[model samples]
Target: MTHAATANLPFKVHDIRVEGLQRLPVEKVYAALPIQAGDSIDHDQVADAVKRLFATGNFEDVQLGRDGDDLVVIVSERPTIAKIDISGNKSIDEDNLRKGLKQAGLVEGEVYQRSTLQAIAGELQRQYVSQGRYGADIQTKSVALPRNRVELKIEIYEGKAARIRDINIVGNTLFDDDTLLKDFELKPSHFWSFIKGDDKYSREKLSGDLERLRSYYLDRGYINFSIESTQVSVTPDRKNVFITINVAEGEQYTVNDVKLAGDLVVDENQLRPLLVIKKGQVFSQQLVTYTSDLIKRRLGNEGYTFAEVHGVEQDTGSDNNTVDVTFYVDPGNKVYVRRINFTGNAKTDDEVLRRELRQFEQAPANTSLIDLSRQRLQRLGYFSTVDADTPRVPNSDDLVDVDYKVEEQPSGSIGANVGYSDSSGFIFGANVTQNNWRGTGNRVSFALSRSDVRDSYSFSHYNPYYTLDGVSRGFSLFYSKIDFDQTSVASYAADRLGGSVTFGYPISEYSRLSFGATYEKTDITTGDYVAYDIYQFLDEYGDKFNEYKGNISLQTSTLNRGVLPDRGWSSTLGLEVAVPGSDYGFYKLNWSGQKYFPLTRRWTVRTRGEVGYGDGYGQDKSLPFFENYYSGGIGSVRGYESRSLGPRSPGMIYVDNGTVDPSPDPVGGNLLTEASLELIFPTPFAPDSRSVRTFLFADAGNVFQTEFNDAADNVSWNEMRTSVGVGLTWLTAIGPLSFDLAKPLNDQPGDDTEVFQFSLGQVF
Candidate 1:
């Protein structure tokens, strides 16, 4: 910018000339200038134009000049960013760092600013410090390239996270230091801290810990407790952190009285019983909050979705040890639902989710009904998250709309694997399963497996909402070959080819009635040294038979959860009868049930029982040997070998010199009974894990042969086998894996006792 160019600034301009512009259009320069062509300008206007051009951050410098009424603008454009590269980043992912940079207006193709780069560097450092990485280092550089572009590079050195060396709580009188520390997630470094990682310090985690500390006192009737100050100091090397929390422990208070105020929709007496806090009980913030929630829930059930219940407390006298609590209820207008909408379900059809909803579109917005709808979708296993919100319509106060958002997850699997099981021997299999086939909420599966004891090929399909009225339909086709000789049972083999079609109708909200019709062909093959029971059945009936069967079952469940239930009961009763056209007419009845009682937030007690009986009917006089129920396995008695318990058939004793070997084949019985009691607890390290659980269980069960054995003999109470065990079940990517360690308490002479049992793809 020369002095002569600014001399004649008030002259009229004919045209504008832009100089020294690169990667920027001449029109943009004209648009940025305050003075344009054919316009007269003054010195101040000229200076203002120069200032405006520089404000765009695109120009390094701007010079204003005039030549015979034509204003000339000379500009030096800033370098455009061409690329951004990052390296040495670990704790914070590279993609996220680049995203943050872009959000801060530092993306490629934009003009680069030196000031912005320094600000971004400071921001990056602050982020690392919040994560306890006080020693993290960050460096940025710009490399000039052809075409007036610059490439930005960011280097990061993520350091070790600071660990807490000590945590001290000062001025604590009501509670000891150890008790207060137990409520904090951050702990001092110890031998096991490396694995638990609780010693690692983070700003967000520390803040949350302080909140928990406050809640601990507030929930225990310390109404006046206050946290005076909290100090956190880092070591000189920034490798360790020390935290000290100071507090004032106030006197505990007791509840003076409880009263209900304001407009109560129902009778005050009706809501009084819903309160958990009594007049004589100690003041508990947690109880007050819980009671308020309960009141809201109770009102919600009555269609008072917008009701508000707030607890107001008043202290009396100088002692200040008694607080009067009053719950004020404001029952607003009862709101009704206007419409239901679904979002974020691109892969699933709308009708599939609509059928699961219990709340109607135009009905009142029942909170419980909406919650049940979400639970139903979660139980389908097709989504990872299901959320529902009822927002009021823009201009309507009495009508609200229900909106459901779902995040879909993988609901199908296709794979092949090779494994081994003690009961089935070496196994190889391939399977294709889809629980939500094509997002229609249909389940379809096909599998083929080969093992030493069993070989099977099966296909099944089920539709849970066949008619949208809570009816279900399913069909299955299977062919299986079982070798009993490998199972420590009778030396016999059976090949069964069968197919069945089932239909189910919902009897109630928690119960269903189902019926199935099946057709099968069974070919039983006997080998040498077969059990006497099997030989007798083969002698009476042919080795091959064709049968037609019908089954009816009723099942009901009220468990709070589908995977790991905390409280509820479930039961099933099934009856299978061979129709009149079967070669061997028979009938089987089975009853099973389970009940869970939550003893505490982290502990539960469960009881389970099952009973089964089978007998021949019509022309047949007794149950077929192969159809008998055998007890003792992972599903029955834990401390016994698979299907290796029950009545035993005679076998020859070999005598070689002075040694005698006894071989007894386990012959399954027609009647079976089993019961179990378990104390379930959350895993120690993962107390909130829904996929893992541990339990101590006691099991008692046995198989009885009634026809050949007298009722007073084999059916006695002493004949039942018993075991006590500790078990664990973990749900994994492949399937659920279960392990049990048991000790047989009442083992008979010939019973096979196995102290350790494990199985895959099974749960208890």
Candidate 2:
């Protein structure tokens, strides 16, 4: 509606009117228009009004006309989407389809645009094509509805993924095609191709395979190896794919000499020892990179936080097939910390974190100390992420600020559960724990539970930094009452009350030594079907007794995380002995260790072991049956029942006509040994979630008695029971929940086995 297209008349409009509007408010059209009834206007204003109306995306066409010096605006409204329907889609879920439609401006109740829908359909088809489904097709149509509304219908037919038929490797002599393809994920068609479908063609998988090919050559001294080309062709039917690769492998090269270049800042003699490769060794790209990293790290340790190192290989003429390697080091200016800052600790006190810092303000910036400080914060079991930054101060080449940012995890957890199980009979419990109370780095916990056969209550408190040197002090009290009238173990009940106090000394950053003293009093009550072993112990040591004990232990850990740690190892060895004048005189030695190895980005391998042996000193060289160790169930062997995998107790029997009566019950032994290996993997479909994990494990363990009447030998590996299972752990807001499904591999005739077990607890 410009002067060239319409009558060139510049005059003031007397009024404004809208035309061809339906199912739309007049105010909307007027709001989009830039031209209004004004004192003066021109053809340029009319053109701007039409452009603004079209820019609203609510109209199919917009035009301006004049009638009696009044402006007349006309528009054709686009059809509004009434509904959406989809069919023949399996690979893509309904939620993703709706999300895609919404992103592409084709959502229901929005104005329909044919071009946008058509373009989205093509983009979706390309996604399938990338997955080797070249025959996939997408069809879209809009059905007319009443009042100018339309229903969008999208149909997707996702064809089968093309299978790999064959693979060819050209220009490779030292390594055969079969040898190179052995490590590839994509393989030729085999007998199980139709069933497994793992041999299906994938562009990403082929790319990885090609990188592996390049690495295979580069690692074996082929310095000039290069891939000429790679071609993947699909059949006309799009049901099969063929791949071919051409490569050039240069002559193998060996290192003749190694030297250092550039400004190392540190002494050359000290940096020379860090070199991993020397003369007469084959050239290796991986070792070269590793050596470069080591050099950079050493430079960082010497106050140069922004050091750089690179390894360059030079040809040693054309005769001997040798290359001289040199590392170029650039140690940037030594920086000093101007200030130290901490953030993201809204709940934790700054003093609690500052005490763990190895780096100080107004000191030379040491990168190693900064990283160590971050690790110290992480190991506190309070924060999920600890990040450190040493950025240069404004316009200062030798000054920087050490800044630490931490995201605190949930240091407090509440757990409560109500359920009924036949074995436990109406089980219910609640637990409250706080590892960092009021941001003082103190721990407090309380627990209470009741069941048909058992009742327990406990309370505890600990201060991790009682003094400035990180010494710890803690104490706990517990009371329990049990009646085992309807359980798998010996039929006996006991009422026990105990309390303990402990002091910890930090031996190093990763280890601690602890000493504790305990006092316990126990009262026993026997049932009609009580085992003879319980009765014998009661008769020898009296029905009730007060015990005094002392324990000393040393523990060490380098775990990367407090909960579900993904790396590092931990170990603890302890000795507990009964004090003089106590009713019991036994001493126990226990040791346990766990190590985690990261296998991949999402997979880890964990190994663990535990062992315990107890025996009395003085005249009484026999261990009390109450101090015995029992294995199996949730925290032990998994498949077997709780405390149900040990020597059987000889029950009291009444002989009739000189025939011995049968009496059998499980009685824990004084010696315990166990070992476990697990493959920790990310939870399926929720791999990005940090609060959940899954693992598969194999466990083997058993309890044995060294000086018991029914003892067969000191120890026997053949008697050990083994189980394999899959488990899942979820850190919910309330607490941590774990579930295990296991199968026993060597269950005996009388062994009790449980296929499933679970525990939900709050760790403090």
Candidate 3:
């Protein structure tokens, strides 16, 4: 600035001019100038403008001057940032560090300020220090570049986190140090600390640990417990931290009585039963809090969304240490839902989602119904995430809007493949399955496959909500030609065509009764050599026949989740009978059940059982060989091939060669029984426990026949095949894939034992 600009005398400015501008607009400088054309100004005003310009941080220096009624503003502009490269950052991700620097105005392509860099470095140091990285260091450099730009580089050294060396608890007589510190997340250094990192010190972690310690006492009836002080110190080497906590243990208090004393919108009798803290019980902060929450939720279910409930303790004057408790209830406004809206459901229809909701618009908000509705939507398995929020309506305290935002996931699979295999040459197949067909919540599936051993075509459609009363309707048609000669079975060929219609009635929320009718036509051809049992059966019942059958089943499930349930039980009991008017008259009864018991957050114990029996009631006098029950393999007894464990075929006899094969072929039996005990554990390295699971299972079962020629074929628990195995089920994009490695614990001489079994493209 010139001496005339700094004169104490006041003067009227005629014009203003800005100098030393690069990359910055002229308007930026004019905006910061207080003295403009035709405005009165003084020395203080000029200094004020100079100070304001510097405050903008765009100018390195600012001065004002006058030249014959022309105010001249001279300023030194800061350099724009050309590049910012941060290195030596290990504990923190580089992207997060860049974001932190950006928030402090130290980003690339913007004007650079040395003070901002210093501020960022200081803040970074403090963050690391708070995390117990006392030796953490930070250094910054600004390299001047051409074209009025600067390059910034930040170097960080995040030292190792300090380890907890000693944790001492003083002034506690009721509880020992180990008992109080057992649940604390922070602990003293010990072996394997490198892996668990529980010994690592952190200010935030310590705060949480202190709160846990306080809760531990408060929950154990120490009503007057108080923490005197807590001290933390670091060693000179800065590699270890010592923590000391002193607490005062007071007399235990017992509850004299629990009484409801606040505004009881609901009946007092109804709320009183909800209290977990009863008369003459030891006082517990945890129980009191739980009872308060329970009461609040009970009120919330009655449309009080903002209800508040708390238990207040009043110490009775006596040495008995008994206290009277009163629960204060504040039932807030009854909020009504003005509208229920949905979003992010691009493929699923509105009605599909609406049908699952128990909450409705234009009704008072019910907390239980709203939560249950959300759970139902999630259990549908069509959405990746289902979230519902009820926000109060603008300008209205009694009205709220319920909004559900869902992210849809592909609930179906479509696959096509063409390949050649030795067992099935020149294989060509196509299959499509959709659970939410056309956004209508219907299930549709179609399959077409061709190979040397088998050629199959099938299609099915099912509507879960076929009726307004939750009745399900489904029908399917299938045609298949199979050659048993190429498989591990007695030489035979069959061509079958069938169609069935099924109807399901919802008996209750967890129970359903279903009825189905089927008609099938079968044509069979036997090879020159076949199992003796099959040969005798084909001779009696003609190779070609038509059959009609009816089926009824009752199923109930109380599973907590639709996928990978960890709790609850499910059972299905069904019977299928061939109509008397048909070519065959037979009946089959089957029951299967499974129950899951959760052992921990990531472990579950499961028990499963299945039993089946079939026999003819009319002229046939025996179950058809094809309709017989065949056990063994993944779904039954592992370590045995599919349909490989059962009554033997006696022996395969070759009529052409006049030679008999000693090895027996598995010819299924009339009765089947299976039981399994499993320990289901979380899938190792799986991103989600719901999509994958692993289990160790012990299986015991075998098929038996009443018309057995030997004791081995007879129904006997001693003859039941047993196996132990580990299995993995992964719900993948293609479908559920399951594989198991099993070892048969008991195997008869004629029993078939295959260790490994697997199935792809199946729902679990």
Top candidate on TM-score is 3
TM, every model: 0.80, 0.75, 0.92
Per-residue lDDT tens digits of candidate 1, residues 1-764?
23225884477878888889878988898788887666777887887888888888898888877676677788888999899888888888878888998888899989899889889999999988988899999999999999888999988888999999999999997789899889788889999998889998888888998888888987888888898998889999999989999999888888889999988888888899988988868888889989998888878776778889998777866474898999999878788989999988998999999998999977877889999998877666666567899888889878999899987766666668899888779999998777778889898889999999889999999999888687999999999998876765436778989999999999898899999999999998664446555665676677998989999999998866555566788899999999998999999999999999889988999999999999888768767777889999887989999898888866522212222224668878889999999999988867787677899999999988877422212577688999998998876665567899999998978788999998865567
**Ranked candidates (TM-score, high to low):** 3, 1, 2
Residue pairs in collision within model 3: none
Each model's lDDT comes to: 0.84, 0.85, 0.84
TM-score of decoy 3:
0.92
Model 1 quality (TM-score) = 0.80
On residues 1-764, what C-alpha lDDT tens digit does candidate 3 reach at each position?
22224553477888888788878989998887777799988767877887788889898878777777778888888999999988877878889888888888887898898888898989999889878999999989989999899898888889899999999999989889999899999989889888789998888898899899888887877888988999889999999999999999898989998899778999998987899999889898999999999998899888888889978988997899999988999898988889999999998999988888888888889989898888778767677677889888899988988899987766777789899877667889999888889999999999999987789999999998999888999999999997756644446666889999999999887789999999988888766677777766776678887889999999998766555567788899999999977788889999999999889888889999999998888677778888889988887898988898878776777746646776677788889999999999877687354677899999999888986332235467888889998999876776667899999998877667888888766644
Candidate 2 segments whose C-alpha is farther than 4 A from its true place: 1-163, 182-208, 335-367, 373-429, 433-441, 449-455, 481-492, 527-530, 597-604, 653-662, 681-693, 708-718, 745-749, 762-764
After the best TM-score superposition of candidate 2, give how far the Cα of residue 520 lies from its true spot, in angstroms: 2.0
Q: Which of the predicted structures, 1 or 3, would earn the higher lDDT when compared with the native?
A: 3
Q: Global lDDT for candidate 3? A: 0.84
Model 2, backbone clash pairs (residues 3+ apart or across chains), number: 0
